[model samples]
Every structure is written in C-alpha cells, then in structure tokens.
Target: MTHLPLAGRRVIELGTMVAAPFATHILSQLGAEVIKVEPPTGDTTRALVRGGPSGTFIAYNHGKKSLSIALDTPEGRDVFRRLVASADIVIHNLSPSATRKLQITADDLAAVNPRLIYCHIRGYAAGPQHDDLATNPVAEASTGVMDDHRIDGRPSRLGPSYHDQFAGAYGVIRILATLLQPAPTAEERRIEIGLYETGLHVAARDLAGVQLKMQLLGRPEKEGGGEFSMPGYGAYQVNDGRWLYLLVLTDAHWQKLATALGMPEADDPALAKLRERKKQRERVEAAVRAAVGKLGFDEAAERLRAAGVGFSEVLPLERVLAAPQARQPGKLRDLDYRGLHFEAPEFPGQAECSPGLPPPELGEHTVELLRGLGFDERACAALVEQRAVAVAREGDFAWAPVRPEASGKA
Candidate 1:
C-alpha cells in the first residue's frame, strides 16, 4: 500500500452531524490522525436511531477516534485547548453562538497554535441569514436548490444531504490548498465555508447553462424566463412501471435512441438537425415515451443496450448495491469493524486504503488519548470522575451482532 498524503498529520474534529464529520472522514481515509471530539452525550446522530449509531453516523465517523468531553466545564475547555495546541488542523461545524459558548472558535484555537489550520463549516454565510439551527435540508430549501429540483411545481429535496456533503468536499479542498501554500499567518489560517454558497458552487454548470440561455434570449435570468432546456435526456416509464433514464448528448446518440425505440421519425427531414430536434422537444419526448411505454422493462432494457444507448434502470438502493459499478474495489469495500461485516464506500484515488477501523464508541479513546497527551493515569481518572470527560470501561473495541430477540422478544 502507498503512503497516504496526510499520514503524519493530526486533526481535531469538533464536529457533529454530517458536514464536519464528512470532512474529517476524508482526512482519516487519507491517513490523517483524526480525533473526533464529541460531547459526553455523544454525537447527536448516535441517538437518532434507537439502538446505536445510525448509518449516517457510522459512514461519516469511521476511521477516527472519539473523545467525549463536556465543553461547558473549565477542565474540558482546558483539555481541548491542549489538544488544539498539539494538532495540525481543527475543523468544526458548530453554530456561531455554539462556538462562542464553547470558546472553540478559529480565533480561540489560533491563539493556542498560530500555525493551526482552523476550518469552520456552517449552513449559511456569516451574516444575518445564518440561522443557528439551520440543518442540511433547511439550507437546501433556503438556497433555492429544492426549487430547482422541482417536479411539476412541487419542490423536492434530493435523497441525500447534498449541500452538507458538498460543503465537506469543498472544506477538504480548501484545507489541502491552504496546506500547500506558504506558512499561513495567524489571520490566514481561518477558513469558512457555508452550505448555501457551496450549493451555488455545485450548481455552476447548470447556472452557466441558465446564463447562456438568458443571454441568447436577451432576458434576465431572475425575471421568470431563461431555462437552458435539453431534449432526449430524461427518464421514461415502461409498461412495467420502471423508469429508464436515457442520455442522448449528441446527434448520433439521438439517432441511436430513435432507432432503439423503433420510432419511424429516424429519417424525417424535419428532425435531421440538432436544433430542429430540440425545437420539437415535446413531440420527440411524447414519441419516445409512447415507444418506451409499449415495451416491458426487459425488452426496453435489451433494446437500449443493443442500440448502444446511454441508459439505465432507475434502480433502488438494493439494486445499486448489487450493480457492477458499486462492486469496483475502490468504489466499495467490505469492512470487518470489530465483528460486524458490511460494505462501506471508499473514496476514489485514495493512496492509503481504509483499514476498516470502526468508528469509536463515545469516549472510547478518552483514557488512551489523555495518557498519550502526557497526563498520568491518576489525572485521567480524576477528569473522568469529575464528569468533565467520559471513558469507556469495557474493551476498546467490540461488535455484537444484533440478535433478532433484541428487537422486542428474548
């Protein structure tokens, strides 16, 4: 295995929920020593599900150490300051007031370690619009992203927390870029990314298309006109009620699609040109929809494949997991964390593969980490006794297969 780019770096992740954890998860995969600091109650996601950590929590918190500390206590704050002083990067997604309350702001950490790269991920920019309680879905709705994804005038959120994930990815990129530059000054070390702005960044291509269409039509984008429309690239329902998405990017693709659907308009002079085909979008769409509707799922899939058309069945999660693309080595890997074996998604272009390290249970490494930080065993015990910190007393790692009886009956 190749050495990961961040092998020797230490990161303190003061994050909860998705965005910040997602960022640190990437860092952990890149071989960074990511220490996730959670409150004594543990991450909010851990309690979201009844029995244990939800899938969301596990997905974003894997390959990291957990330190459960009570930030409201002076001792806890002191411990965090010490950790930040010894860390290379400090990242968090707490609200503005939460940062002030906990005193873990970028400025606060920078005071202890001037060279530390402190990144703050939030749901909105530093302005009046930033709601302290805003979440991923709220941010998406506020950013017009949900409206853009409307189907028949009813706005719908994408299945996943798109903005939260995008913000995390952007945070990682910004952190990497900052690390590559000359030694950052105290002021230069702080970076802020808002979910709303990140949403706009992710929609650049679509926005560009909107802009071009507005320019061509000589209208303003916000004035209720100007949508960059495309034809022959959408989903059509078959006889069996399965949706088949098609991508006809070029004229040849359009021809192939038409032939695949057995549409008689293949040699029609009126639709020969790409512009003409686009102009007749409604007619073309109706024809394709009708053709696809006539065929069953199997026949439609076979004909589409035979025609070399870019298409796919709109598969559910189970089908997607079983697909060849999902089975690729780097795309997904079987993890044996403790004893629970499951497949986890792996990042592309990762140098050091994930070691399948399970996410630490709340405060699972508190004692060990405190000892590593030069605290004596007695001092660590005192902190735990004071309720300023919590440490797991059992084995460091354990996985119990959820028995059927655990659901309700013994």
Candidate 2:
C-alpha cells in the first residue's frame, strides 16, 4: 500500500455522531492522527444505525484514537486544552454556544496552539435562524432540502442523516484547504460551515433554472422545475420488474431514443417542434415511462446505448457490494478492527492501512493515553477508579447515558 496523502497530520475532534467526526474520519483514513475526544460514555453513533455493528460510529471514527474525558470537570477541560494545544487542527459540530460552553472555543484552543485550524459545523449559517438546536430532520426541513425529497412539491424531511453528512463534507474541505496553505493564513481561523449553507451550495446550480424562469415569465418561482426542468433527468420504470434511468439530452441522443421507441421524430427536434411538449414535462415523463415499459432493462439499455443515450439499472446495496467493482482488490478492503469488520472504500493510487491500534473498544486507550500524557501509573489508575474515565473489557459495560438535550441529531 502507498502512504496516505495526509500522513503525519494531527487532528483533535471534539464532536460526536457525524458532521465533524466524519471529517476526521476521512482525515484518519488518509493517515492523519485523529484523536476523538468524547465524554466518558463514547459517541452516540455507536448505536445509531439499525441492526448495524456500530457501523455509523465506525464509519466516521475509524482509524482514530479516543480520549474519553468528562470535560464537565475543570481538570478534564484543562487536560483537553493540553491535548488541543498539541494538535495541528481542532474541529467540532457543537452549537456555537455549546462550543463556548465546552470551553474549546477558538481563542481557547489557539491560546494553547496558535496555528490550530478551528472548524465548527453548524445547522443554520448565522443570524436569527442560526443554530436552532437542530437534529437531522429539523435541519433538513429548515434548509428546504426536505422539500425536494417529496415528488408533490410539499415540504418534507430527508430520509437519511444527510444534514450531518453535509456538515462533515463541508468541514473536510476547509480543513484540507487550510492545511495546504504555504503558511498559516491567520493565527486562528474559525470556519463556520452551516448545514443549511451546504444544502444551498448544492442547489445553487439548479436554482438558476428557477431564476431563468423568473426572468422569462416576469414572476419569480419559489422552487426549481417550474413545469420544465428536463425530460431526461428522472427515474423511469422498466419492463422486467426493475427501474432504470434514461438520460437522452442532446439532439443526437434524443434521435437515437426516438428510433428505439419506434416513434418518428420522437427526438428533441420533435420535442422542440411541439409547443405543448416544450412545457408539458409530465406528458414527456409519461411517454418516456411507457417507452421503457415495453422492453426489459438490459434490452432498453442496449437500445439506448446504441443510440448514444445513457442508462443505468437501479441496484440494491447487496448487489452493488457483490459486483465486479467491489471485487477489485484495489477498490475496497474488508478490514477487521477488534473483531468488527467492514468494507472500507480505497482511493486510487492511495493506500489505506489499519491503525497501529484497533477501534479503541470504547475507552481501551484511556489509561495508556493518560500514561503517555505524563501521568504516572498511580494517577492513571486513580482516574479509572474514580470513574473519571473507563477501559473497555469483555464483560464490562461502556454504555453511558447521554443528556437528552445534547443529542446531536444532525
């Protein structure tokens, strides 16, 4: 395996669940030393996924060490500061006020390490709607992303935890950029990446369609696709008990599709010539659906490809994981960390190695980390005896109760 791109980097994560932990996950996968600082219990994501093996937590916190410290104590906060002082970057997805409450504020961390890159993942950007104590669903609805999930144009919520993922990807980009600077651009840069902003950034290009309609119709639209977006961009059902995507956009592709459908000028030219077809997308959608139902997915795909059209069969996760792509040794690796195994994605020309340590079995590294921090054997033992920290054992229970309000849904 080749060396990871960000090897030798250090990151201190003060977030939980998703968002910032996800950013650190990618960093850790790329060979950065990520230390996840959690409260004595551990992160909430350990049980987030249904019937999954701490998969949600493992997916984000892989290849990182855990520091189970109850920062509720001044001693804990001071210990955290010392750790943050030694880190090259510090990140969290806690609310702004919660960040200040945790005492890992930008000034606090920078005071300990001036060059620290501080990044915070938020729900709303700023101002009146900023940080509404949101969970994944609340953040999705607040950002108008939930509305897109519904076909009827009604405002609904997202089906998954995308808001958190959004903030996670958002933070990862800024952290990578900050690390690549010739030198530190500023002493302490507080990058605020809101969940809403991430959604907006994603939809900006699509919003142009609505904006263009407003210009042509002399009235602004409240959403994308004001009766016409494009006929080739949606899902259609197939004949052989499956669904497929038919994308025939360009003139030539449309012509090919027309021939495949056995309809004269069914191409975009025919589409362009029809005053009704130009505005009636539902009619176009129905026609395309009817055309697809006449042939099996494979037959339709072949016909479309022959005509320079694009198509793909809807595949389940199990099918995807068993495909030739997944079988490629360079594409993925089934790794075992402390008895938990999962397939992790591998990058092209980049190596992903298991850590010197396992997933840390909750607080398995607590005493060892304390010892490395210059704590003597007796002191380390004392902290454990006092329940200030914990060590994972086969029969031991590490499940800790989380304060309900502190539950980070997003």
Candidate 3:
C-alpha cells in the first residue's frame, strides 16, 4: 500500500474477461485506483469456469472497483464519459466492430482527458485476416502455433488461455511504457494489441521456424524429439509418476548429467562429440528422462543437481500455489470475497508489490467518486436509483456484492 508506484494513478477499465480485465488488474495491484465499468448485467466472465461463474474472473480481478452501469442508456453513457474524463488510462478488449458499435472509442474518451493512454486489446490487427472470427483456439490455430506444437500433424489446444493471457501481459507492458514517456499533448494516445498476432510472437519457436524455413538453407529437419534449444531441458517423469525438468546445456553440464546418471562416457563412439550425441537426440533424451523412472523424483532431482544439471520438481497447480514462494508476503494474496476464496499474483517487485485494496464490489466507490466530481449524496443516490451507478459494500478490500445486484434482489 505505502510503497506502490501507481498509488496516485487512476484507471478506468471498460473491458471484460481475462485480457483487458487482467491488464488493468495488474495496474490495481500496483496501487493504481482502477474503476471497473461493467454493463447492467456485469461482465460475462462472472459466469465462467466449471463449478459456476467466477473461476478466473476473480483470479485476475482482485483489486479494482466495479461500477455496474447500463452503458446502453444515455445517462449511463454520461457516467462513462465522466469516469473517463478523470482517468489516466482506459482499457478495453471488445472486438473492433463491437468497439465502434459501442461508441466507446479512443476519440470519444480522449476528448475529455487529453493525457489519456487508451489501450485497446483487439483479437486481431487490421489485415486480410483481421476480420476473421476470433477465439483462443482460432487465434492459436491461425498463428500456426498449434501446428508447431502438434505431434503426428494433429492440432491441439495450447496450455491455458495462452493467447488471452499473453495479450493481457502485452497490454500491461504497453501501458507501463506509455506512462513512462512524456504525457501526450493531445487528449489520447492509442496502444492496440492483437491476441492473434501477439500469441504467435509468444510462441517463439513458431516465429523462429518461419525464418528457419526461409533464411537458413541448411535447416535441420524437425525430429521425433522436442525443440532443440538445449539437450537436457524439459519434462521428465520419475518412477513414482512425479515429473521434473532439467536444463543443462553446456559441455560441463552434459558431463555432469551423464556422470550423475552413471552413463559412462565411452558408451558409444557418438558420445565423443556433443554434436554426434545430439544427432541421436531422441535416444539420448530417452536415456536421461527415463532415468527418473528408476531413480524416483527426489533422488533424481538431488543427484541431477549434484551433477551440475539444473533440475526442479514439477508440482501440480495446487501444490505450486502452496509453494514457499507463493506463500511469501510479497508474492501472492488470498482474497476472500464473501465466502469465495481466490488468489492473485502481487505486483512485480520492481514495480509495486506491497498489496493494495482488493477489487471493489460493483460501484463500491460511486458516492466517493461522485463526490470527488461534485455530486452530493442525494445526486449519487439518484444516479444509483436510475441504474447509472451503484455503491459497493463498505470497507471492502475489493468491490463486494459478490454478485453486484444480489442484495438488491432480496
């Protein structure tokens, strides 16, 4: 709270789901004052995930204020305009067409706040394929990452919402950099991110392969083994069904790893040269990773590191959450909204990591924000009754209705 860099900054998040919400959520974690503007029904993400709505919704939205307003209404539009007029940044991830349809464009907001940094997370950049349909799978499929990571030429889903999260992180980096620069003389500065394009960039190997096929004439054929960045790198299974990763890439490390496995140097003539050993990459990797099946997880990790191989246990998501680093005061936080338990990564250490307010319940700060803008209690209440804005619960770490309109129902 006290040490956050973005303490005095103000942000208005007019976005839904992972990418845009997460980008702004990171800002809130940095102590920035973020107001999440939702439509009357709330962000659709609130109903996502298996057990019910709100799996990742809370995961990436734990420290911002929510303002549920009917953006389709004229009064709602005015409220949004007022919110943007007072913000340092505005974030949104609606489709290009949807953005125009909503009339919440950069031009619209920046007209009020000249120094506004408007960040738009689009599913695609302008081009021949830009207007094509978009979704996580389509983004990955279009970017050819699915093809690159595929085995037997069969496509597969990339881990997690890779495109969505990558786009979220990309938006964060853009905002931070824009903030560092001289504030624009004009009202708005536009920063657009395309999930389809950015996802391909994040799939570094796929980007490398484009050049590999074009620039490098002597490109080696793709093999049965994995990517060739290093020999002793990536997942290996242990006898007890545990897994670990080893990343030993130098001559000394190779020797150390081989010795740790008691895999003698004179096993075969190919062992004489690292190049020759790499030519038999599949067999070599099989020998190394397969050793885990005999050595057990702990024994293999210990022996491997002792032999100079960089090895680490691969814990499941739950186990990883309980890891020492995750429990550290400055790394993560367990946020309890009503009875719902959620976790969020703290701000980056180099940025602002001291814990800030939890995500605000819908319109939690409506009165306060309205008062700041010259509204009296009566005016604020009038606006709330009109469904233009609503108050969040009191003393909430983040906004609190859990369901912003739930209490109103009862």
Candidate 4:
C-alpha cells in the first residue's frame, strides 16, 4: 500500500467544538498521527447532544488519539510540553485569554520544538476585539454573512457552521504550506486564522460587488437577494410534491429548459436573450411553474436530463446519505464507534489508505502514550492519581446509532 501524504506527521490538537479539531481531522484523514488534548472533563462537544459522542464531535474528531489532561495543573503542563517537543504541529482554538493562561501559545511551545508548525484559530484577528469570545454565529454576524443570507428581512445564520469549518480549512492550508517550506527556519512557524476574518473572506465577492455598484451608480444597490436574478434559476415543485432546483444560466440553457418543459410562452423571440428573459422573469417563471406543476418529478428529471439542462431533485438531509452520488467508492468511509455503524465522507483527494481508527475515547491512549514518553506503568498511575491526567474506563464509550425506521424509505 502507498503511504498517505501526511504519513509521518505528528499533530497535537488542543481544540473543542469545530475549528481546531476540524483542522486536525483533515490531517488525520491524510494519515497524520493526531493526538487530541482534551481537558479532564473532556471536550464540551463530547456532551453536545444528550447522549455520549455527539454528532458534532464524531463528525470532526474521528481518527485521532485522545489525551485528557488538566492543563491547569503543573504536571499536566509538563506532560503537554513533553508532547509538544516531539510534535510536528500544534493546533488550538482556545480563547486568547485561555491560551495565555495555559501558556501553550506559539512562543511558549516554540521554545520546546523550534521546528513546530503552530496554528491558532481565533474569533478575531489581533485587535481590540481579539480577546473577545466568538462562536460561528457571532463571527457570521460580525461579518456580513448573516445579513447577506437574511430570510424574511431578518438576518439568519447558515445551517452549517461554514465560517468555523472554513477557518479550520485555512488552518490546514497554512500548516501544510509551512510543512512544505523548503528550508528550515529559526523563526517560529506560527499561523493564525480568525473566524471573523474567514467570514469576511467568504463574503469578499459580495462585498466587492456592492462597492462596485455604489461607485458606478452613486447609490447603494437595492437588496434583492435570494440567489436568483435570472428566471428559471431557482427551485420549483413538481406534481409529485418534490422540489427540483433548476439552473438556466446561458441562453442555450434557457432555450433548452423551455423546449424540454414544452413551455409555449417561452418560445417568444423577445425572451430568447438573457436580459429580455430577466425583464419577463415573471412570465418565464410562471410558464416554468405551470409546466413543472403538470409533470411528476421523475418525468421532469428525465426531460431535463434529455435536454441537458442542469437540474436536480432537492433531497433532504436524511436522503443525502443514500444518494447515488454519495455512495460512490472513495466518497465515504464506513466508521464504527462502540459498534454503532455510520458513514462519513472521505477527505477529498486522500489516497485510499488503511481505515483510520475511530475517534478515541477520552484519554484512551494516555497510558500507552505516556509509556512511550518514558513513563512507566507506576508513574502513569501516579499521574492519574494526582488528577493531572485521565483515562477512559471500560464501558465509558457508547454510541446510539440511528434507528432504521427513522431513515424512512431511501
């Protein structure tokens, strides 16, 4: 078998919720040895749901070792420093104050491992609000993401924690770039990714568009947001009560869609051009709605496919797993946590490798890892007894699988 790109890399992850953990998760998927450092109480995400192993935790923390330690204690700090000495990378999303209090900042750990690639995920960049606590929603709101995606005239956060995930992705990008640096440097390899900054980056095109319009027209652009400026470029319900999102971008696509749906009203030459179609959006959309309303989803999909007009049935979350596209080989990996079978998407472009271990139980590898760090069994026990470290006991790990009936018919 071929080695994964990150086969020999070692990552020490000190993060909760999403950002930092997600960065390490990607590294783990690429075959990095990720040691997740959690507090003795465990990561808060462990209990995000009512039961053990919250979905949030499982989604982002699979395939890593867990080391539960009380960083507040001197012994725990010593152990962490020891781990950092041999680690290739260290990533954390702890608040600025907490980072200082714990003394795991880039400078602190750089003294132990000069070649370390350290990534710090923060709510904001270094500024007045740098120390402020921020979550995904807070960052989205601070930037214009929430406002840009407003619904019914009220700001609404996106369904997924995209800002947090993007921040994590950014962390991964910087870490990998540092690792690929041709020459070893004396200066610390420090990377900082702020959720707020990531949000702004995500909204860059929209921000630029608005500014450009203001400059050209000398007035603020009118708010007309809902993802579609052109006709036949939105969701429509069919006779079978299923939604299909249609994309009629080019004039050829518009013509194809009209012809496929047999919409006589769209045959007018005036509606052939995109600008003309936009001017008569209501009529074009009405024709589309009426035509689609007359056909079942399957028939509409067939006709659209035959015409080569882009369209897809809007499957809900539950149906997404069973989607044909998702079932393709290498798209997802079967994973089990405490015997509860589930599937998760594989990292894009990852080489096929031996299946990774499931998300580790809290301190699941503490004894083994400590022993590798030159601590004997008795010393490991002493540290545990001192409340400086924790180990997962038998039966401490459990998982509640989704009931078959809950999935409905795929």
Ranked by lDDT, the better of candidates 1 and 4 is: 4
Between prediction 1 and prediction 3, the one with superior TM-score is 1
Residue 218, candidate 2: Cα error in Å is: 2.1
The model with the greater TM-score, 1 or 4, is: 4
Clashes of each: 0, 0, 15, 0
Q: How far is candidate 2 from the true structure (C-alpha RMSD, Å)?
A: 5.3
Q: Give the per-residue lDDT digits (tens) of candidate 2, residues 212-317.
A: 9689997765544432356645567787789886665555555566687766437445475334454766767777778888888778878877777777777886
Q: How many backbone clashes does candidate 2 have?
A: 0
Q: Is candidate 3 or candidate 4 better by TM-score?
A: 4
Stretches of model 3 off by over 4 angstroms after superposition: 49-53, 129-133, 151-153, 183-188, 218-232, 265-269, 340-343, 350-355, 390-410
Give the CA lDDT, 0 to 100, for residue 166 in model 4.
96
Write down the worst ten-residue block by lDDT for model 1. 220-229
Q: Write the per-residue lDDT of candidate 3 for residues 126-165, one digit (tens) a residue.
A: 6777655576777888876677567567888776887887
lDDT of each: 0.81, 0.70, 0.72, 0.85
Q: How far off is residue 23 in model 1, in Å?
A: 0.6
Candidate 1 residues 322-399, lDDT tens each? Answer: 888777666765666546676778887753354666878889889888888888989998999998899865542233
lDDT of 4 by residue, 1-410 (tens): 56778998899999988889889989998889999999987888886553477787887888999988999999999988889988999999999999999998888999998888889999888778878888999988987778777789899988888888999999999888878888757453888889988988988877887898899999778445543677888899999899999988888989999999998855689999988877887888888889999999999999999999999889898899898877777778778887678787888764453577887899999998888788888989999999899999865534444578856432
Rank by lDDT (best first): 4, 1, 3, 2
